[model samples]
Target: MNNTISSVCLPKTYTYDVEGQRVLVALTGNPFNYDPQTLYSLAARRNKKRGFLFVSKVLGKHVPVNPYVPLLAGINLGAHFIEKIHGVHQVDVQAVVEAVKKNEQTKEVYARVISQPRFVLPRETLFIGFAETATGLGHAVFSLFDNAHYLHTTRDKIPMLQPALDFNEVHSHAVNHLCYPENPELLKTSKTVVLIDDEITTGNTALNIIRAIHEQYAIKDYVVLSLLDWRTKDNRGNFRKMEELLCLKIRTLSLLEGEIDVSGSSYHEQSPQNLTTDTENRESFQVIVEEQLLNLQEVVSVFSVDVNGQESASPYLKVTGRFGLSSREDQDTLPLAREIGENLKPHRAGGKTLCLGTGEFMYFPMLISAFMGEGISYHATTRSPIYPFPKPGYGIQNAFTFPCPDDEGISYYVYNIPLNYYDELYVFLEREVSLERLQPMLRVFSQLGIPRLSLVIASPVSRKTEKR
Candidate 1:
């Protein structure tokens, strides 16, 4: 319970536990705290694998010049910072590979899974990255696989979407994906195709996507990979049904799989004040640590902002004077945001801020986290339908409900942010959203606390930049 830290966007919880250590140490490289040998030993026991491996997002953060790493060279993985590449960013190969090797050690039956024969992949294959998340991931995976042809899903307003085949990520922030293979014959002509993503759960996402391609392009062979495979027994059964229904063979490979069971209300329900994996029948996805909070006072100050869906300005904004991640290569994004997060930490007095983004806009929240100093609780709000469950054993839940920043008049990601933890809050809105609509938006944020709520919209409503 003592390990929790606070920051903007992320949920507050303990820093790291036994499970977290295993998951995190892959990227963290914190040697002295727990023996690298022990994590290696622990990971060795789980040995699980799939023919193809897909890594979840590999997440990274820049910590203030810590006093400890200099003293301990093993901890000096790098100055850019130690990031855990799981579920948060593009699945990091180092972490996924290490964890896969570790898990293989404990479970001998699983060991052989990671030991599959290495095949010489084509120099380039058609690569499909899911929207938003797999944006960067698709390319990363493409880089690893030979002859990778790369394309990602997008929300860009197009005159006509010549989708080869389409599928609805019904449970996603928005059930919208459009694909126009550069070469209409690419999928049709290729004998093998590789799909990239951060995680592969029920295999529904993979199945539907694969089905779409197969139906439209008639690609017969496919490979699915993720950092973790938390597919339950039923989910696997349904996967087989989809395979039989489509009459195609699909193969999946992963670095790790959930050993502990998970089945509860919604995967996200517990408050920032009470995050405990100890609950019965509940398995939790984590950035780090576990905790049973003793008080709310530990929450220093909370800053909340609602991210707009537009792709301009920056992927994320900052209250503490730091810039976060930007999707496009803007000369303006990197230097400013990185500078702010790095310099702001030492000035802080151990307070917490909650930076909440609009539905489906997770990339911004993630960028903001990298800007924050240590002790920040990180989690973005999404519009996906999730049950408001706070007990253990819940695997999935809708995150939140919010209108689209675009003209579609839609709603997106709706989980992870609860208002009780904030003391001071901020909301980011575009200039076009009139004060009337903005009023209702502010009303939602008012629940956090009375603050000199600040807003930013550099461009006016009539001529703002186009959304990506």
Candidate 2:
């Protein structure tokens, strides 16, 4: 297949061939001045439901980007939301766009924009981020609003807490999404609800959640926000039908809007290589546990039981907005991140550092990495598997696969981490797990030649550790 690259302008078109599957993408709307290449790259998914995946460049999920890049993208999306609610002249959307563009060159401008006062929404709004991938992106967008309630859907089920809502992402590897709000009143009230995700492939996920929410809460207004909107005309008509059926309003916003055409037969799957086999000096790596940071927050007493009835609890701070957070509580994230970053600073070996966030725990670590000083890149482990192609312009050049530290039965992957590129690595986990389960991940780091490894756990539970 032939590939064509075009300038980042409206009505731009490009094609990608991933493992013999052909994907043609056309950008009919580029009002935000986003260069497609900088925003995302096309890669084939390992799943059969979705053949291709837009590995986001600014999402800090599949790619290790400067933390400022994803934050700027969130700021830009927030500004766009304000413009849609208030008049376009009300917010300086261009300023946010310029800051997003500046992130391509340097991150200095991000501080200036973040220091500016947040835009206070005219009314209370409930912002819901989809689980796994959009957890951090949703928080970034929610942080820009001074009057909003935030929560992200989760796949994990808390034993004591009953979910306020349940929905599904049909094409996702993990289909079920559960919403658990600490306060039930958060759903009953809140006139406006914003559904945030990284991309809108068909708009079905948004519609499904909207329908679910309306059936219970009957919220009148809904807004679906994403970095990319690829809904075709018929797919968009579904949203219109839903609005009419519910007698409500639905507005959609995105940095780029286009149609994606994917064709060709199924791609052959190859067995994953054992990347940890080269860990000859695994015992030589230093493992440090920063337990002093446990003072930041208390662990949720409720246990999350997996399929095997294995009970696990998250040791993370409540500020993740998982159990629902008000605008004031959301503001506390920065200070907490700063404090953790300061505590981790002295332990740094002063070379390139990589901050790795476990699944669904991205935004906080990204923010913490920003405060950890320069030469730092942030990304997270994901359940979504994509084909790794070691070529220029490919989104995932390499991958490290391991059993999830939280759940050994599940496979987790971290992509694009080049060997011998980083001097130190900090793996942040929301829950406290035994060293036995973490050995798989630690061994992968050992193979990468990262000499210093820090396991930053938010749980206050003390555990025995061996320091090399």
Candidate 3:
């Protein structure tokens, strides 16, 4: 196999000029024999600190992908982790590559492979997924371990739940990440802690979190895993420095490893305005909100306190890993997803349907979409802003902006939804939202000419509060 950094097989260099700022990406490693183009595409981030974004094709974030694809990617990563750390080859990497190569037969491939019993780790492992982008990705990775605890960092400030640890993502649009594990013992008891993310650039975020966790829990072993690893020589040295300082073992792994260089002066780009308007066909679409499954006794609910110290019942499910989820609870979510999919499958108006998850609430929706039957694509709304360019080889072609349905104070975005691409749309939200708060998002769908829309609420109030 050719291991040259500037090989002609894959493009040696890629350059993207976004609004006068230039970013260049070079391939330094491709050990898995998968094409870089198949994994991710380059796009310009709207943030000044980080001007470029590697929008993953299989992540089910910026781009719509088969729900099983991301799951397979995670399983593949988990297989690699097992092989590297435990010297056990659990799953075939080539099979995963073949399944993800065309995005076809992925459901059968995933179902057949994932049905096998999970690999039991020798030691208890704590898996923490980064907030926003990698919430689902992290969960997917954690799912492959039979004996593991999972939690994803959150930007949401839930009152009364004191954060176990907080870290900063220096280049992220939302810098702060709060970890609110219901049981703090999960951090202290685990022998190995795995930090999962979609990508690792400078490795500072991992190091910073490690330092914070060591100050409190002080675990001996920590592994940082990502889909892409783009750390330079100097940036990687920081990890060594951190290990020496903290006196702990640190290991890094990724599907792809490479170096990146960004040049050219930064440009201040104005935020894209919400251009969605009420179209003539807006009345032609049907909006249905489903909450029957939420009423079931199996559904979990926790309370949240407001700034005034007034407590209100929260609809956020405990299975999301935001409050920490055990392996058994993680496995139980599969049946719940099937129940949801079965309930909503009859509502699908046509063969073409899209399931959209809101923000960090991604993995569940993608899981439901997988069981919803054929011709279903999954993606999510994100807080990260990317310059949308309608061209071949670009990750984001078109974009839609709207206020977060649950929190109107924060802006959320959905990308690459072409006009009339889907016959129906099922939007999955973690919390019950009023129709008034959902109007902006509904209008965006109306402009897209989606004839049918179903709001799949995981948690709803005992009484019906939303009206059309």
Model 3 scores worst on lDDT over the 10 consecutive residues at 274-283
Per-residue CA lDDT of candidate 3, range 1-468, in tens? 011235585536656665455666676666686777789877766676776688899899999988999988887778778889889877776788788877877887787767878889999999999989999999988888888999999988776677999999998988999998888788988899999999999998999899999999878799998999989999999999988988999998898887877776544454444332224444444544443335434334555543345444545777788989989878888788888788788877899999999999999898889999899999999998777778777777887888887667678899988877798888887877667878888877877877777887777755243311
TM-scores, all models, native as reference: 0.47, 0.92, 0.91
Candidate 3 clashing pairs?
A: none
Residue clash pairs of candidate 2: none
TM-score of 2: 0.92
lDDT tens per residue, model 1, 156-237: 3333325564676654555577664434665565666666555555677787888778777677667665444557668778
Off by over 4 Å in 2: 6-9, 88-92, 102-107, 269-293, 314-316, 462-468
lDDT of 2 at 418: 81
The C-alpha local distance difference test score for the whole of candidate 3 amounts to 0.80
Q: Please say which candidate is ahead in TM-score: 1 or 2.
A: 2
* Consecutive 10-residue window with the lowest summed lDDT within model 1: 60-69
What is candidate 2's lDDT per residue for 398-419, written digit by digit as tens? 8778888777778888998887
Candidate models: Cα lDDT each = 0.37, 0.80, 0.80
lDDT of 2: 0.80
